[model samples]
Target: METSASSPSVSDTPPGHTRIFLVVVDDTEEMRAALAFACRRARATDGRVALLRVIEPSELQHFAFIGKIVEHETREQAEQMLQRMAAEVNRRSGHLPSLHVRQGKPVDELLALVREDPGISVLVLAAGRGKEGPGPLVTACGAGLGSRLRIPVTIVPAGMSEEEIERLA
Candidate 1:
C-alpha cells in the first residue's frame, strides 16, 4: 500500500464524512472508463480518489526461486503503473489519488481494501464491451460479491464518451 503519509487516515474520519472514490487500476480498456467516472465524480462531490492495483501471485509454482524474482518484477511494474495513473488522476481531478498495491485475487484484494479503508465511499467499475462479457471484477461484483461490500458499487459503461461521463458524473 503506497498511500500518502501526510494525509489523514480514513479510519480516523467520522462515518459519512470522508468520500473517497475507489477505482481498481488494470490494463483493460474499460478501466479507463471507470477511472474517468471516478475522477469526475470525485471532483463533483469534492472528494478524493483512491486507486488499488492488485498483483496476482505468479504461477511459477514449480520454481520457487523464479517465482520470487517474478513477484519482485511484478511489484515494481505495478508501482510504476500506479505512478503514471496517479498523474492522470491528478490531472483529471486536480488532486493526486491514493495508491495501493496488494497481492492476491482481485476480488478479495478489493474487498479487503474497502473493508480496511473507511474513507472509500464508493467502488467504481466499468462494464466491458466485449462479446464475452464484462471484465472479471465487474462480473464478480454482479455475481453476489457486491453484496459483501460495505460501499456502493458504480458501474460505468465502457463505450460512454467523455461528454456523456462529464454530463452524468
Candidate 2:
C-alpha cells in the first residue's frame, strides 16, 4: 500500500493495486461468515484484508446479584475465541491474515482502529440481535455503531447459511 502526505484517508493500493478490506470480528457465527465474505470479496477484487476483534467490557459485574446465572466469557476467553475465528478465516482465505485484538467498547474500538489505519476502506460487522429477538430488527446500539463510523459498514444478518454467505463472497 502507498501513503500520500496530502490525503486524510490511507489508500490500500500500491500505486497500481486496486482493492483492500477491513473486517471486524466477534464471537458469533454471523461474524465468521461476514469475515469470510469480506475475504472473498477482497480476493475477487485483488485486495488485502485485515481481521480485527474487539473485546467488549464484561457485563457480569452489572448483574453480579444474579450470581453465576449469567455466564459471560472473560477477555482472555474472548481473545481465544477471536483467535479461533481468525484461524477459520485464514483457512478459507488460504493465507495468514493480519489480526488485531483490542479491549474496549466494540464500536469505539472499531472506529478508532479505522481512524488510525488508513488501509481499512470498508467495515464488515455482524448484525446484532434486537430486543424482540432474531432476524435483523433495528437496535439502537447496533445502529449507533454503523452511523458513527466513518467508513462504510456491511452488517451480516444472523442465521445465514454458508451458501447464502458465499454469494456475497
RMSD, one per candidate, in order: 1.9, 7.6
* Model 2 lDDT-worst window of ten: 1-10
Local lDDT at 157 for model 1: 81
> Candidate 1 lDDT (Cα, whole model)?
0.85
Instruction: For candidate 2, give the lDDT.
Output: 0.58
lDDT, candidate 1, 1-169, per-residue tens: 4443233444555658758888999999989989999999988887778888999988996899999999999999898898899889889988778888899889988988888877789999999999969999889987998999999999998799878998983
lDDT of the candidates, in the order given: 0.85, 0.58
lDDT (tens digit, per residue) of candidate 2 on 52-155: 66665556666775533432345445556656755665567654455666767665676787777766777765654544453221243355755765667666
The regions of model 2 sitting more than 4 angstroms off are 1-18, 58-79, 128-142
Instruction: List ranges where model 1 is wrong by over 4 Å.
Output: 1-14
N/CA/C clash count, model 1: 0
